[model samples]
Target chain A: MPNAFSRIEDLETTVVILSELAAAHEAEKALLARVACCRYSDAATFAIKLALEEGMNNAIKHGNKFDADKTVELVYDISEDRAIITITDQGCGFNPSAVPDPTVDENLEKPTGRGVMLMHAYMDEVAYNATGNQVRMVKRNT
Target chain B: MESSGDLVLDVRQQGSAIIVRLVGAVGMTEATLLGRQLDELVQQPGAVVVLDIEHLDFICSSGLGALINAQAKARPYEGQVRLARPCPLVMRLLETTRLTNLFDVYASVDEAVAG
Candidate 1:
């Protein structure tokens, strides 16, 4: 079977955790360590860190609604050239296009909607599965 | 001074402004604590809250939300929240979110206190 993350040299790391912010934090720490080991530029590291945080937060909070029974899955491949990550949740997904633009004048003050915007801004590429339960973000070393 | 996991908050008074120095990361877990603390600070009469972020290593959207919420809460009271010494990473986020115009930003905590 062809691996989805075969392009990156490193073996992909997969993590599954209950829909808890604490567990997500742990997963993030481990993944960030891997990113650091790859020696990505400081700017690239910052971008990846911000996007990863937003992606995991959305999966655990918005997607799973913090339901203890629900789980969030994270998969990542980190190489010197780029880092690719996917976060999936065990809840009904919503359309990304339906999210209101946070940059709009009226919505700028609203805080909750900026997560998705930040993910898009910091990542080189962001794509969601058809069901919207999974998000894949890529940050290329620059 | 208050600490929650990776985030530390040190609040001090500088003239009429209340300066809160944040250190470490402010992700999802730390945002709750930051929001609550900012809420309490903004409730003071004519409060001027200055955030010293020189040492803040990281912040996510939730943390930005907390800042916006504090600013909103202070508006009715003729109070405001000012940001000081944002690191490069944080500056990029402020610029990306177009929040640079929404909040008064300064190069130093002293400037924020005076502004």
Candidate 2:
């Protein structure tokens, strides 16, 4: 509960819903454009973009299991100093702690375990709901 | 701005090396595409693959994983995967993941192909 996020109350929020991977991609790119327009540095924008991609991919692929019947919800608010994004899927949730660290020797070559790690690494704060179905991430401008 | 989640891969053969130039943002869908293409290329005899990322706009975790997986696939055959001119964002990602040192990166494709 830092004051930085409390400032989120002042900014407008946008919500996007999608059931397909192609749609999710477009939504993510639009979100990134908004983030960049807020004047965040190149690195900060890239970090947010990466986190958003991973978050959306997880919601669509892992959570929904690529079921077209299920939909993913993305809510985001960006200000001059920070960006906050939350993604929720209609499928059963997962335990975030169960993800294996991709940096380890044995897991380093694996291709699928790095999404959660990248989200945590790029975003200033990454939090999962009690049921593990929803994730909220925050990135601040430095 | 228009957003297309398209990840384009342009492959060409230079001597014994296979050059794959990636363009646009890379996500889960594109990762699979890249992985499949790399699998085919790695099977070739003496496949020295060079990934050119100069035109790549963005790359997610799975995209990074695809690159590493491709590199791993080439190693057993005495072939290798080299990275050329990764943008600042991709470079930062590789550095953060601690996988930057695992691959040989060159300034350009000519340098990588020659090396």
Best by lDDT: 1
The numbered model that scores best in TM-score is 1
Judge the docking of candidate 2 as incorrect, acceptable, medium or high.
Answer: medium
The sequence of per-residue lDDT tens digits that candidate 2 reaches over residues B14-114 is: 88788988888787768788878888788766689998999887888887877788788887787888889988778878877878767888889999999
TM-score of chain B, per candidate? 0.97, 0.90
**Which pairs of residues clash in candidate 1, taking residues 3 or more apart in a chain or in different chains?**
none
Q: Residue A77 in model 1: shift from native, Å?
A: 0.6
**Tens digits of per-residue lDDT for model 1 on A1-142?**
3565354535778899999988999999999999999999878888888898898888888899999989999999888888889999987987998988888888889866799988988898999999999999998887
Q: What TM-score fits each model?
A: 0.96, 0.88
What fraction of the genuine interface contacts, i.e. the true contacts, does candidate 2 reproduce? 0.72
